[model samples]
Target: MSRRSVSTRGVKWPIVSAVGLHGGMDVLELRAEADAILAELVGAPGGSARLREDQWQAVAALVEERRRALVVQRTGWGKSAVYFVATALLRRRGSGPTVIVSPLLALMRNQVEAAARAGIRAHTINSANPEEWESIHEEVERGETDVLLVSPERLNAVDFREQVLPKLAATTGLLVVDEAHCISDWGHDFRPDYRRLRAMLAELPAGVPVLATTATANARVTADVAEQLGTGGGEALVLRGPLDRESLRLGVVRLPDAAHRLGWLAEHLDDLQGSGIVYALTVAAAEEATAFLRQRGFRVASYTGRTENADRLQAEADLQQNRVKALIATSALGMGFDKPDLGFVVHLGSPSSPIAYYQQVGRAGRGVEHADVLLLPGKEDEAIWRYFADTAFPPEARVRETLSALAGAGRPLSVPALEAVVDLRRTRLETMLKVLDVDGAVKRVKGGWISTGEQWVYDSERYAWVARQRAAEQQAMRDYVSTTQCRMEFLRRQLDDEGAVPCGRCDNCAGPWVDSDVSAETLTGAVKELDRPGVEIEPRRMWPTGMPALGIDLKGRISAKEQCSTGRALGRLSDIGWGNRLRPLLAENAPDGPVPDDVLQAAVAVLADWARSPGGWAPDVPDASARPVGVVAVPSVTRPQLVGSLAEGIAAVGRLPFLGTLTYGGPGGAHAARRSNSAQRLRGLFGAFTVSEELAGALARSPGPVLLVDDYTDSGWTLAVAARLLRQAGAQQVLPLVLAAAG
Candidate 1:
């Protein structure tokens, strides 16, 4: 296990001396050795591959000087090469495995494979591979693993942090923070878990050679990350290069609407050269685009947060191997996907941050001569941006409530248990907890979270500043879409790239290369697809965890008899189809009125389609009792007219009785039911809807299936609780029908 014994491809690395020189080798000789290793790492033909000057400087700083460094280079700038070459050199001197904190699973997988190409043994311990943790840890302990990749969230796992992190920190040769922008609150993709690295950086035995690398950080983000990297008391070496992708030809395609944008894609996707990615702003949009493109005889698939991991892997492989034309993806497929020949990138809607947009489009044209990058900005882009921005750091009051609850618990409280006491949804709650954990306000223990009892002051000023920064970024994106200047230069300037200049390749600089004209046939088909309605609303089968703690006495599987049957919604609020039409009507500030005639017609069509579907209530089907004999409306605190009118209209169309609306008997009126977490929402909704005596009598008289109508279904708890009440009141079955599903 001596340092000299670690050989790759019959090349003997120089031994390290106590003075940190490679066996008395001078700088030039060491540089020669690094070049030789880089040749093997990149498979450079004839061993002629060499690192860029900056890449070489980074390697030398880490290996020879043992200094922390921050590298901000563009996507295809051989940043990975700097680390793998540094790992090879560092291990030659008998340093423990290099620990990499990568952000995404796609990035980790790509890094592992890339490491193998350079004769470095790399392993990952992510949520996706829990069963291999023990073996991976053993490999690291035995020095059989050269590189260990882990997600940033893994840094704070109670067991991993307490048991594994200390050992890794002590023996680590080099620490790499990939996608380093995430560590900065100023960055577009700020992640709280990344802040835990500050503690590890402080604990690192001096001169452990820390490196933080990113392709997306602007000047502000760079300064923040560099400052964090220097937490151990030595200034980090900052190496930033031009943030331009020479292989990219940028353009903006301004279409009239979602249908035209989709139509344009269908018309021109085949001509975009090799396989690529079609980026959508939401899961629904990605799925919608994927379905339309496939129906148009194009090979496509959807990749989003909701896609199964197995399917994501398959989709990645398909796109990599050109098995499919493209993967209709959200930001899930954004970073570190190692398709060097990706031919194009198309955004169905512009992202709110130009920096994020740059990071995504950088995935293309890595190894190729040129790749097309088009921004098809949508009118609804700003609305989608606002929806995502709603999950920013919670208010001071909410944070204090969470801390108070944890303090009063006297024991560790799991997130689900905390949901009963706190109002934040699961994801936002977890995010807040991570931030609090970093701030010394709370601690995650074996079971769940516990109050650290540390006097924590809410940083309201910092949070407000971050919020304003987000707003400014959104406006910048608006400017990007409308700017007549070079699109690439605009992005580069946003990143504060000093080397940014007009590329003379974008649509504004040169005449548009992409044909914006959508064929009449394609336009008609896309419009028809978007116009189609009725998405299945899968009913919740199990109550929220720890519901009994809310005094509802509900837990485990909801009884089959009490559960509402599968329901239907005209569309999802995040979808590209009916969502556009329904969003305005369902907006909080929208005027309360009867359902519009067009929307009513769409709802009626949804019901008809539901009745005719297999396992539906069509008379041609075998089951006579399946058909709803009457319609019951969930009393809408905000939109009673909309809900009642829709119910009456559906009942009239179907020749069924219109049962009266359920009574809103719960506390706090509509505000209480608007809680974010499922547990709290259920608690608010448990007694909210009561079947009135008139509705009870109507249900009892019908004694068959009933259509439970509502204006919207967000948590589905409103529908579930209302259905439970209706079922208890003598309705034989409850079927939920709604205008829109919340994304």
Candidate 2:
């Protein structure tokens, strides 16, 4: 936003008409507080400041909740508007000043500049000389500044923490965390620093609330975010839902080259109204797309992670105001920004995941107008995509390095100092630490580090990449991309099986592309035990009810915690409705929440199986307590014959969780091999067993002494569909299995 002669940018709404709390609290009161803040700014500050409806609600939530809240909003969800709005409201009520932990220098200054334009008093203390920083500190301490926005590192400074934090914490009505997903390692971008946010908030009194805002969070990403915030297990009231955009039109086009797509875009400029965004997979692509599109007769702008924030912001504004008809950019183009009315999001390459694609596409249609997402799917893009995934997860070494630096410092180091040891050059690391601060790993004060960011011991980027790639591969393995049938029918039916109704808003339903039906036999109906390969799973030692239990405590083996709490697992999954493709479906559907107890049970089972397996692995316990559980060995199969036979006994219970099947194949893989050998010795007593996908996959593909192996839960739809397909394949005796379950 900029101020110029006759511009509305700098103009503020009057007290009588300004925005207010969701309860419709008086805006006049907010204006008065802002006015008071202005009056105390060494002089009458200037114009007026107000917030939009969503901003007002965010402020009220932070002030009243007395706990951290994660706000999953849409693009154009104002980052600064909420804080200033809260400040304005509280100032009117005589509440303390607000402290905003911002991500960038330009963000702070841009906000300051906007406030300056609005005639409000605001400035940055960071990057200033000692004397200047002190001056700003005094202003904040004196409650002269209504809203003091500083980077997490700046706030972590010992000097800032000592003098300003406590004072600010007590009176500060709300602490706002913008782009909140930056806190989680699972996000599109990961920052180790974001892990320390919780301790920072604790510095304040019991009542000061924290506000977390983000544009998007996929299922797993959503969980990771909450975990970082100390509220993952259903403690905080989370507001999560896709920001429904009507004006955005999403389309997928399989294009061969950037030049071709850019040229096509130029030809469609009339439809775009000279206002649109073109997303590239990389900075190089952004630049090329920009140049090529520019030469094609459109004034194109571009930005990447390498672009300076100031210039990027200008490009954003230029694009928004129509100074530029279009912009070519990498994923870095739109964070903490609101350009609501752009007409299109043309992706030069397909995003690694649909969620990323969704978030980027969501940028358009902010005004709820027509917009489009043009994706060019290419396998070649995988390398670049992997680069992002690889980069998103910082190496464990860098994280450990950050921890070592923090441990060495007796007091909070300034932001610049903390980043010195970090190898990554991205400015987001510090900001990410701030995000992680919401999680318990890092500690913080308003001014700065009570503790530096926490260590994510897991190679999250690698793990995360594996999960994404795994999901992608799972889909490919099922071969839906090659399906010639009504894609919508197939996809929607899969979601329905997974409990997701047809959105009807997506391209498959309304787009020009149409698919004719193929044979019903061809579809992956619902994954069934018959389709899956199985394996052997025996208790490491029999339970107390059996010989396995007798062997464990009496002699050689593990502890209780490491042991599978079958009782706990049973209790947790009780509400999971007996499985059949749980993760992604639950992420989108579940009456209680995304992760049902059954799914939790599945997680626990993984540990139990690991315990039973020779490896002494406990799926849930990442640590040593994960010892062997029991030993009552039963061989399973990588193939379905044994599992299919078992399915005949169970009468098809709600579709096998992983592969829904009426009947699965018989003994195959190592499962049968082991059983064959054991059976010969034991005679008829040892035969191949069966399992549900939930049990099979959770227990490393061996379920209830049997195992299954088909590992993709993309939207959870394919699993259900595949299970159905297996059932149709009709080998019978089907069991279930999955290695890792993710949304």
Candidate 1 residue 722 C-alpha distance from true site, Å: 0.3
Find the candidate with the highest lDDT and give its number: 1
Candidate 1: residue 711 lDDT (0-100): 84
For each candidate, the alpha-carbon lDDT, in order, equals: 0.87, 0.47
The local distance difference test score of model 2 is: 0.47
TM-score of each: 0.95, 0.51
lDDT of 2 by residue, 1-743 (tens): 22222112322322333432223445455445544444332123443433443444455565444566677765655555555555565565576766676564545655775555434567566653345776787787676877677665555555566666667766776677666766665565444444445556656666666677776665666666666565322255466533544454545555443333444555555565447777777664566556555654667788887687568778877876889877777776644444556667777666565545555666676553456655655444554443344233355676566566667777765454453344443344554455445444566544445454444444465566746754663354234334444333333232122233434544655654322222222222211111121122222222111122223222234233222221111111101112223323322222332233344344345435544654333233244233221111122233233333332222222222323332233434322221111112112122222344543334443222222233222122222223323323231212233423321
Q: What is residue 226's positional error in candidate 2, in angstroms?
A: 4.8
Q: Model 1 Cα RMSD, Å?
A: 4.9
Model 2 Cα shift for residue 283 (angstroms)? 1.6
- RMSD values, in order shown: 4.9, 20.3
